[model samples]
Target: MGIVVDLNGKREPQPSLEALTRLVAADLKAVNELIVRRMHSPVALIPQLAGHIVAAGGKRLRPVLTLAASRLCGYTGTRHIALAACVEFIHTATLLHDDVVDRSELRRGLASANAVWGNKTSVLVGDFLFARSFELMVEDGSLEVLAILSRASSVIAEGEVAQLVTANDTETGETAYMDVIKAKTAQLFAAACQIGAIVADRPAVEKEALESYGMNLGIAFQLIDDVLDYSAKQAKLGKTVGDDFREGKITLPVILAFRRGSEAERAFWRRTLEDLDQKETDFDKAVGLMGRYQSLEDTIERARHYGAIARDALGIFADGAEKDALIELIDFSIHRAY
Candidate 1:
């Protein structure tokens, strides 16, 4: 939906995070500086390993949400900057642990911390990041913010455990998959947004609205990520296509494909995903099955549904550049597959 073509057959520019990034540019710079300063440590490896992942360069969407949300709610204070850094720390910690759990070698096209340093160091650095996040939260000196972020941290851990239970299980349903992503991914988004309203001393209604927007946007974001795992375009973008398939991670695409396939196809899924007895050709075969079942397309459609909800949730906010950028972010999140 984001793509457009003129009579000349050239694809027009699609929706992007540029607007949001530009809107929060200065605050983002502050957050980045704070992150670099806080990640420092006397233990040489701590900074080294942490710096590696930090330098790997992601979109920093979670922290951006914090910055944008605070501005949207008319906050003029500097508190959001440190809090945004806190959110980034939480996200970076999760990525470190996730790469270790998945035995991944790459992150944002660079060697993952775990791949370079071993699982022990990666995990310890992740713990350090988590500790740093909590320290930032405490320094903010808001019990409500503390409660929100602490709850998100616990929910994220629960989501990871839930995903582990559902992993490699072809019988996992769509509902269960949604639950895992909402917790592991969306909980922090919600917290990041809600705290912005809190810091601004906005009303409860505004807080709830922003929370809902972040939650739904996060779900849409993860759904597309799952679809990207099977997309050829993902490889060009530096992500390893079919990582989910190789890891036996039962994402929405796999769940839908397995549910719709014939009995023979189901057995194929069990062999590749459940039993983890995969040959090199299995990834192609799996992608073919997903194509046959229209699973990838349907997953995109599912993402659109959540994106719609996220857009609507922003209805409470007044029209401004912050709101506009945030709304565009929903489109960017869903249409990034292109």
Candidate 2:
């Protein structure tokens, strides 16, 4: 809520991804090794295509969640390493599928997997990753872990399909949008964090606590992504600015702006977004309207609410560097848009 100076730079006192990396450095390294090891295949193109996306340098937050939460619960075993890798594979598979669904050309500052390789290849590789992830889960030999992850997988798919169904219609309510994101995005985060407790043989109360943290954090993360789509410069944000607009995606910002605008403004949105009749200046006009209505700021503010919840969910853990970093990570999710 303080003054946002550089729309490109992070807010002051934001959680450093590097700091979190350092906290989980050794486990992360082992997870990365396991990721590479499990990705190998007799089929030449499988590893070739999957490696391209893996090498693209995503933040790896999902896997880090697994590693960090396990350590937070004082788990010291090596099983968490492979399980962390499984989390990454699930995330990577979703990204591959999302790019194809979104028809995105660029991914994480480079060509999307579907862009460089064909859609068929991208999808098959995604499937392969999913299968590989299950292999690791089964190898871990915990039916509870498998049940949690597989349920997450199904919920994620349902979330995507729900979003797809809601795609261009301007009548989508806040409740509907919340449901879609909770399923599509927050479910994975919840599952990822909860698995850390499972591996630690922690009690259900601790598992639910981690799940709450991850779920709210994921909600905050996606809400910021919605804010950044309109507020960030294309080069800095990586994905093209106004992509959601172009794709006729109904994000929170657009939803707020649409609902708050005048009849003419609503008509304009319907013409461009609902009717797929965007002009070059339409994007700027949309931004102007959103700014006038304070939609972006409002969206960021909502993100901060969920972030606060994510932080409070960690109250059960005693104070330590791990707990501190996790709290900061929540701040990082909301403040990254600054």
TM-scores, all candidates, are 0.97, 0.95
Which window of 10 residues has the lowest lDDT sum in candidate 1?
1-10
User: In order, how many clashes per candidate?
Assistant: 0, 0
lDDT string, candidate 1, 1-338, tens digits = 24679899999868988889999999999999999999999999999999999998889999999999999999999999999999999999999999999999999888899999999999999999999999999999999999999999999999999999998899999999999999999999999999889999999999999999999999999999999999998987778788899899999999999999999999999998989999989999999998999999999999999999999999988999999899999989988776
Q: What C-alpha RMSD separates each model from the true structure? A: 1.5, 2.9
Quote the lDDT for 335 in model 1: 85
The C-alpha local distance difference test score for the whole of candidate 1 amounts to: 0.94
Q: After superposition, how far is residue 161 of candidate 1 from its true place, in Å?
A: 0.6
